[model samples]
Target: METLMAVVIGVLFACAIYMMLRRSIVKLVIGLIILSNAANLLIFTVAGMTRGAPPLIPEGLYAPSGIVADPLPQALILTAIVISFGVLAFSVVLIHRAYEVVGTDDLDQMKDTDT
Candidate 1:
């Protein structure tokens, strides 16, 4: 299970980077989203694949093996999602304005527009 999750996240990261290199601004934005998701998964995986367990220690308590999954990763992901959303929203607006003013979605063409 852990290995599978790692592979999945790795694939997402690879795809994200590949898309980020595209000539289209839209693809770049999409890549950013994928990258953020991959990062979240990474944190979750590194935190251990096991569900939450008792944190308290008692005299030979022999606490239960599993209780619930940790909520920290989920919370962290929420923050990441919100941050990514704001960035994506801003990028969309910027891209729209760029397309309107420059008449092209290509980053190369955008670069040449200033001259």
Candidate 2:
């Protein structure tokens, strides 16, 4: 499963890079979304996959016993998700405004207006 996830993450990264290099502003946003997802997956994968109980210590114990799930990666992923959503939202609004002002979605066309 880990190997499969690694492969999937690699594929996503490649796709994201490809999309980001396109001439369309919309594709760049799409690539950013994909890149964020890939990063989340990478964090999850690096943290190791284990079926275990929550990382809660029992009463009188200083630490969790037996196989316990790690919470750090979960927290990191959650934070990343929130951050990515905000960035995606901002990008969408920015793209819409750019389209309205520049009247084009092609990045090449946008570059031509930099006179």
Model 2: per-residue Cα lDDT at residue 15: 100
lDDT for position 78 in model 2? 100
Q: Using TM-score as the measure, which candidate wins? A: 2
Clashes of 1: 1
lDDT of 1 by residue, 15-66 (tens): 9999999999989999998998899899888877885654554667775344
Cα lDDT over the full model 2: 0.96
Off by over 4 Å in 2: none
- Which has the greatest lDDT? 2
Model 2 per-residue lDDT tens digits across residues 1-115:
9999999999999999999999999999999999999999999999999989998899999989999989999999999999999999999999999999999999889988853
TM-score of each: 0.81, 0.96
